[model samples]
Target: MKMSEAFATTIAGVAPVILLVAAVEIGNRKEALREGYHLIGQRQRLIDELYAAPEAPTGLQLQAVAAQTDQPMQSATRDLFIALYVMSALIVGVLLLLAESLALVWLAGSQRGSHPLQAAFCLLALVIGFAWVMLAPMLGLVVAVADDAVVVISGVSRLRRFYRDLDTHDRQQQAADGEQT
Candidate 1:
């Protein structure tokens, strides 16, 4: 078979998978954005509560703030979801571009009936696909690690602020109660 025909066949086989991967990546990004917004809303609500109370909230109000904070903290825990989506989109684009380049090379290399080169092209395509599959988990791991680091830093900051606010609120409450008594 001619190299052009083989290259076309290879592309035909690979394009669907590339497109599918891209689609999945886009979906993940959308989900991440959705969750991010949800967390942002929760955080905003906490800020609202902190502002709305006439005096420092006590007991149940404090508990409510703590409960609301949990959702944002939990949602922010993973950085990988966003990173994976970006990486997957990038990988898919690279793969598609590489496939086109390979097809061009195959067309240029073909001279008369050269089935061996076509076989080699097919093998390379398989190898590339397999390599991507193997590399995906590693990419995910990198994203997850980076995300964890950010979460740790942010969580600490948030906790510090929370504790400070709670302490101040407790002091104010004690003063108010003493005055009332």
Candidate 2:
């Protein structure tokens, strides 16, 4: 293969590796988000318990409760999102490199005499360009979808836990009432 062809092929190989990295990264991120979301939800529940009594907690007590409950959740969210952002950036970098390399090959071939093969190379370059252009926006959309999904999943999970706790409390209260009667 010609130098340009060889370089383009190498670049093409890189594209797949980049895609694999992106997939793995996204999957890892999703798992982390799920774990973090559940953990934070658990913390929020603990804080809610502090407010369960008829008497309101004092301001100092509330502040202490917030400090204890919010730290781990905040840490988890920050770490997960940072990882996602970095991986998404890597996906964009690889896509751009692949497209540019192909475009370079097309440019080199055009400098020589035009042939039927040139059209094929040109088409390949166009496709690469389109893919590169689309990758960033598509990744953004994926991240947005994932974010919304995590939020909804966590909310529903928290609600389920809340209702279950409420049911248990009610049952216990009824049992005590029956014993007294």
- Which stretches in model 2 have alpha-carbon errors above 4 Å? 1-3, 45-55, 59-64, 67-77, 80-181
Q: Which model scores highest in TM-score? A: 1
Clashing residue pairs in candidate 2 are: none
lDDT (tens digit, per residue) of candidate 1 on 78-158 = 544555556656765566656656665655564535556654655565556556555654665676677677779988999
RMSD to true structure for each model, in Å:
10.9, 11.7
Go through the candidates in order and give each one's C-alpha lDDT: 0.66, 0.62
Q: Estimate each model's TM-score.
A: 0.45, 0.39
